[model samples]
Target: MDAMDVDYLNELLEQDVEIREKIKQQVSDLDKKVRVMVGILIKIHSTPTDTLPPLLDSVRPILRSCHDTSAALASLVPPNQFWRWKEMWSNSLRTAVYSAALVEYLSSGSLITLSQASEVLGIKEEWADRFSIAVEDYLHGLISLVNELSRLAVNAVTLGDYEAPLRISVFVKDIFAGFSMLNLKNDTLRRRFDSLKYDLKKIEEVVYDVSLRKLTDSTKSAVRK
Candidate 1:
């Protein structure tokens, strides 16, 4: 092309590269934070059910820090260009959503909604158009949560907490039923959803063992006596 056109194109390419680098750095930082949160939350498998509140509580500030980092990353993208650069931070954001969902599920016995995930990530209302968790990301996060809860069910049994496995089994099955109704079109998400049944099966096994052994009954009788 002409010299002037080439110069303009070159400038645009340089700007794009610069922005990509910044986004990469921000995403790296966010990934580290997500890892830290994951490390903390994964301990739930070994932790007692009653003491889980504090363990879940410990991640709040870190999640808030993640929110700050997420906001900074969002700032790096130009308005209306979030989808263009979304893949750069998609994995990290999904992990962050998983962490948030795990904390909520453990704290309460319920699933975290999309709006709640957005709140946990500190995506303010004004940033909705520019930055938000995709539905696929939220579903992926929930799938991760189900996987974790499956492991937690086995561990809870080891800890003599038979009730947890039953609770987890019901919750996960409910989630699985909900997922069954979705018309998932994304290949990766559909594949991930397919794996969820195995996790549910693991939880069911744990629940069955707990029931077969009458552990819940014994615990209840002991409490009643």
Candidate 2:
């Protein structure tokens, strides 16, 4: 990367921060509303699974009412950042947005259940199909980005390659830490976690939990005891 590239990363970071702030502002009043909605969703799902059409219908107004932020997000990144690393930043932005949303989504258990996500997202109907495709496409891109980023540790850098396992560990940790940026969605964020597993989601859960602990103190859990 050149000076321009460094500038690009900085610019992108600034944009992300700005967008994060905007989202924070947007969702400011949603706390109690979102909690109530989730409670109703849980009640509806507890007994008979309410068919998705009805459920999705119930949520549609809120989803549709969401203030479109494409313009604001666009405003965050400048011409220099967008012009040069458009594709990279786009993928990064999707990763950042979804991950930001995911942190909030997961913590509050507000995410459509995986089953519901599959149900609504899998419909062959034109409207839902496109939405599903977009999310899947972005998710695949995120997976690819992680793979590429992992290889960066092995990529030749200014001096030698990133030889230190400590550095690699730090890089991995930073990736998990970035999820905390989603706290901009809600100020009083709590650490969330699940059992450690090899799957990407599971691994992230572990890190999310650990990150919360580490934030309060320097000590943390170990992979092996």
Candidate 3:
């Protein structure tokens, strides 16, 4: 090729490299912040269920930082590079979803909607609507919550907190019913949704076991009368 063509190609390659490097740095920072939020959430999840309120209160600011950093990173990603970087930030969305749902469940024992997740992340619902990092991505996080809740239901029963399992069972069924109506084309989300049935079964089993134990005890008590 001619020298002019060679120089122009080299310049374009250099620009592309620079853009990638910048995006890498921003994604790295965003990933780090998200990991911290996830760590705190893990701690909260491990805590006794009754003690989660204060732990959630402590998590709010870190979660806010994660949201802010992720939004900044999203803005910095050039339109041409969005498809390239979108997967990299899915972790952030996952953590945001799990955290939001946990906070809502802890507060009210209910499933959180996408709009509620947007409010938790402190981002505009409109901004999250058309972007790859939108509330739809957070929907996957709800799947994670279902998995967690199933485990929590078992643990609650072991700890003699029978009511918690029933509550979790109902919430999980509600979430599963809602997910069934969505026309998800994203393969990753579709696969994740597929796992919800297993989580639903696990929670139902826990609830059944708890209810059976209650019935057995009541029957024995009546026999003693």
Candidate 4:
């Protein structure tokens, strides 16, 4: 309308553009690092269970870099505006959460909690209101982990580590049970949760195959004796 009003609006638009560009750059960098970590972590399918600890350890520094980049991105957003620009980094953040969770699971055979995920991403307690992993993102990451574990189950069988599949089966079932208790209203999250059953089935199949094979071998040994 008036020149003063138009100038003020233009200034606001310029600031928004500048902030968006910075956030995008950080998201892009984070996405690249996440891809690298995923590439490394996926090797768990072929890697022996005994060697996995070192493999996970290799990505520790990269995970720290991810935390640094996330902090930088958070700094660029105005306080309380995190949700507004969250979409730009949401996917990357979910993948980062998944990566951290995968590493923890591989190391200890347990799920990574939200606080641990936040700690992995280097989000401080004071910044919880401004920037943190939403419950939805954490659920999405766990779903991704289930999918990965299903694949790992099949690969573990091929690698002759039948025990890993059994462990994965139990872990996946536990995660699915946890999801069963939640009232997931988000469409994407609900859909992802639906897919968990298929992962569980695949893992269960691996466990069955491993069990049958072990039983057959035991019977053969008895017959020989």
Per-candidate clash tally = 0, 0, 0, 0
- TM-scores of the candidates in the order shown: 0.94, 0.26, 0.80, 0.94
In angstroms, give how far residue 100 of model 4 lies from its true place: 0.4
Q: How high is the lDDT of residue 218 in model 4?
A: 47
Model 2 Cα displacement at 173 (Å)? 27
Write down the worst ten-residue block by lDDT for model 2: 188-197
Candidate 3's residue-wise lDDT over 1-225, tens digit each? 999999999999988788667666766776676677667767743577778778878777766776666566656666546566566667767767787788788788877777777667665644432234454577878888888888888777666566787788878888889889999988989999998989899888877776676633544576679
Per-residue C-alpha lDDT of model 1 across residues 137-182, encoded as one tens digit per residue:
8899899989888899999989888899989988999999999999
State the C-alpha lDDT per candidate.
0.88, 0.36, 0.73, 0.87
Name the runs in model 3 displaced over 4 angstroms: 1-6, 44-46, 79-81, 125-132, 215-225
lDDT of 4: 0.87
Which candidate do you rate higher for TM-score, 1 or 2?
A: 1
Q: Cα lDDT for residue 33, model 4?
A: 95
Query: For candidate 4, lDDT tens digit of each residue in 79-195?
Result: 888688888888998999999999999888889999999998887776655567888999899999999989998998788776788788889989999999999999989999998
Residues 1-225 of candidate 2: C-alpha lDDT, one tens digit per residue: 899999999998987787556545533433333444444434322222223345534654443322233333344444444343243233333333333233323233243332333232222223231122234334333333333333332332212322322233344445445543434332222212111112334334434544454521333333223
lDDT of 3: 0.73
TM-score of 2: 0.26
